[model samples]
Target: MHWFLAVERRLTRTALELAIIAMALVVALTFYQVVTRFVLGHPSAWSEVAARSAMIWMVFLGLAAAFRMGSMIAVDLLVDLSPPAMRRIVHMIVGVASLVFLAILIWYGTAMALRVRSQNLAGMSITIAWVYAALPAGSALALFGVIARMMEVWREPAGAHDDELKNVEGSV
Candidate 1:
């Protein structure tokens, strides 16, 4: 279990790096688009499509990192109010439900990616499927994050702070 956790952490870190790079690329591309359109009086068609594509990848990749870091929003008031025993039960239930939801996303996302494989983006030569592929890829990464989080939750005591709000409050 510990080894699995270590691997998940490494994978999550790599995903975070990729997401950062994608986000940076999106910003750069958008900036270039703005400068060319307004300053140069000539906009490149490819810049808009490229920026959008990068943004899609960034969003999806960031999802896994956010999940792994427990940075997502959640209604944890009820869980925190529950008894220790019940709290653990609720955590397990939430974990299982999250896994199920991610699994569905992976399944449908893969189907959609395949369906659009032959279709190209409107202003680019790249296949639309490549953009769609981010969906399943992110969902798969999120599945691992869910499992890793479940393991952490199981190892810790009940009523522990496992969401972002608690961390923010503690820092303040």
Candidate 2:
């Protein structure tokens, strides 16, 4: 169990680092686009598309990081008010539901990405499938995050405040 958690933590950290890099690329590309279009009066056609693609990757990868950190929005008041026994059940149900939803995203997103693998982005040589791949990749990461959270919940005692506090801190 400890080894599994360590792996998950490492994976999440890697995703986060990649997302940060993507975000930086997006910012740089966008700045370049603006400067070239306005200041230089010669816009690079590929810059906007490249920035948009990077933004998409950044958003998707960031989603998994947020999910793993318990930063996703949720109405937890009901769970908090429930009895300790019921709270565990509710948490399990929520985790299962999230897994199911992410699984669907992974399935359909991968299919769509493959379907469009031959298509290239306008004004760029890159394949559109690479951008689309972020959908399934992010969903798979989120699925792992959900499973890890469920395992943590099962391992901890009911009514444990650590996870709750972390969630609360993340929200704020």
Best by lDDT: 2
Which 10-residue window of candidate 2 scores lowest in summed lDDT?
A: 163-172
lDDT of each: 0.80, 0.80
Candidate 1 lDDT tens digits, 82-170: 68678767767877988898899899999999999999997799999999998889889978877887787787765564553245222
Cα RMSD, each candidate: 3.4, 2.7
Error of 1 at 80 (Å): 3.4
The residue-by-residue lDDT of candidate 2 on 1-172, one tens digit each, is 8787677767777777889999999999999999999999999989999999999899888777776755544727657677877877777888898888888888998999999999999998888999999999988877767777778777778778446636632421
Runs off by more than 4 Å, candidate 2: 75-78, 81-84, 161-172
Clashes of each: 0, 0
Over 4 Å off in model 1, which ranges?
A: 160-172
